[model samples]
Target: MQAVILAGGKGKRLAPYTTILPKPLMPIDDMPILEIVLLQLKKHGFTNIVLAVGHLAGLIQAYCGDGSRWGLNITYSMENEPLGTAGPLSLIDGLEENFLVMNGDLLTNIDYSDLMKLHLEKNALATVSMYNKDVPISLGVLNLDDSGNIIDYIEKPTLTYKVSMGIYILNRKILDHIEKGKYLDFPVLIKQLIEENEKVVGYDFTGYWMDIGRHEDYSKVLEEFNSIRDELL
Candidate 1:
C-alpha cells in the first residue's frame, strides 16, 4: 500500500524550536517524530511512502535519506509555496487506487491498515479517522433566549467532540476535485466532497493520538512517550 506524510508546514505554532528544526524532526524520545510515523507505517504494511515537504526540506531529506534504514521506499514532493494541507496531494504522483495521508508530527497507536480496510469496505471517496476529544471549558457558558433573557447557565463543563485525528485514507478518484498548483486545506476539500454528495465518511478511533504541533503538546508527548512507548511503537 502507499502512504503520504505531510511534513511541509513551517509549524508557526511551534516557533523557535521550529525556527531551527522542522516539526517532524523534533525528537519524541530518541527518534524524530517523523521517524516514528515512518516506522509505524512500515509495520502496518505500507511499502511506498511520499514525504510532502516544504519548510526545512533539506534537514528532513538528510535525516530520512530514502527511508532505507526503515526498509521503506521514501520519496519527496516539495512544495514551492505553502499549500495549506490537501493541496500537496496534487503534487504527488502514482498514488495507489487508495492511499493514506497523515500529518508528520503526531503520536498515535491507530491501526493504519484497519482504517484503510474501513475505507475500502465502505467504498468511500475519503475516510477520516476521528477521535473523541474532551475539551474542558474553563469559563462559565451561557444560553440566552431570543428576548435577551437568561435561559440557562452552565458552569465550566467538559464538552466532547469527534475531532479529526489528521489522518485519512483517500481514493485516487477524489483527486479530481483538487486543482493542481492551488492552495487547498484538507478540511475545505472534505467539506466540498460532502456538499457534492461524495462518499466521505468517518472512522472513529478509540486510541492514543496526539499531534505535537504546539509546545504544550510537544511537552506532553515527551512526558507520555515512555509509558506508552510499547503501544505507539
Candidate 2:
C-alpha cells in the first residue's frame, strides 16, 4: 500500500525548535515525529511512502533516505512552493485504489487497516479521521430569531464539535475535484466533494492524538510521551 505524509510546515508557532530543525524532525520520545509516523506506516504493512516536503525539506530527505532504515521505501513529492493540504496531492502518481494521507507531525493510535477497510467497504470518495472536542463559550450564547433579536439565552454554553484529525483515506477519483497546485485546505476539498454528491465518511478515533502545531501542544506531547509512549509512539 501507499501513503502520503505532509511535512512542509514553516512551524512558526513552535519556533526555535522549528527554527533549526523542521517540525517533523522535532524529537518525540526516542525518535523524531516523522520517524514515529513512518514506524506507524510500516506497522500497517505500507512500504511505499511519499513525503510532501518543503520548508526544511532537505534535512528530512537526508535523515529518511529511501526509508529502508525503517523498513519502508520513501519517495518525495517536493512542493515547489507552499501547497496547502490537498494541493500537494496533485504531485503524487499512481494512487489507483485508495491511499492513506496524514500530516507528518500528527500522533495517533488509529488502526490504519481498519480505517482503510471502512473506506473500501463504504465506497467513500474520501474518509477523514475525526476527533471530538468540547469548547466552552467565554460569553453568554443566545439562540437567535430570524429577527436581530435573541429568542433565548444560555450563559457559557459549551459547544461540541467534531474536528478533523488531519488524516485521510482518499480514492483517486477525488482528484477530479482538485485544481492542481492550488492552496487547498482539507476542509475546502471536503466541501467540493460533498457538493458533488461524493461520499465522505468520518472514522472517530478516541486514542491519544496530537497535532503538534504550536509550542504548547508540542510540549504537552513531550510530557505525555512517557505515559502513552506505547500507545502513541
Per residue, candidate 2 scores C-alpha lDDT tens digits across 75-145 of 99888899898999987787757899999888888888888989999899899999998899999888888
Candidate 2 Cα errors over 4 Å, as ranges: 144-153
Q: CA lDDT of 65 in candidate 1?
A: 89
Q: Which stretches of candidate 1 lie over 4 Å from their true place?
A: 145-148
Q: Please give the RMSD to the true structure for each candidate, in Å.
A: 1.0, 1.7
lDDT by residue (tens digit), candidate 1, 5-87: 99999999999999999999999889999999999999999989999999999999999989998899999999999988999
lDDT of all predictions: 0.95, 0.88
Give the worst 10-residue stretch by lDDT in candidate 1: 144-153
User: How big is the positional error of residue 57 in model 2, measured in Å on the Cα after superposition?
Assistant: 0.6
Alpha-carbon lDDT of model 2: 0.88
- Candidate 2: lDDT of 69? 85
Clashing pairs in 1: none
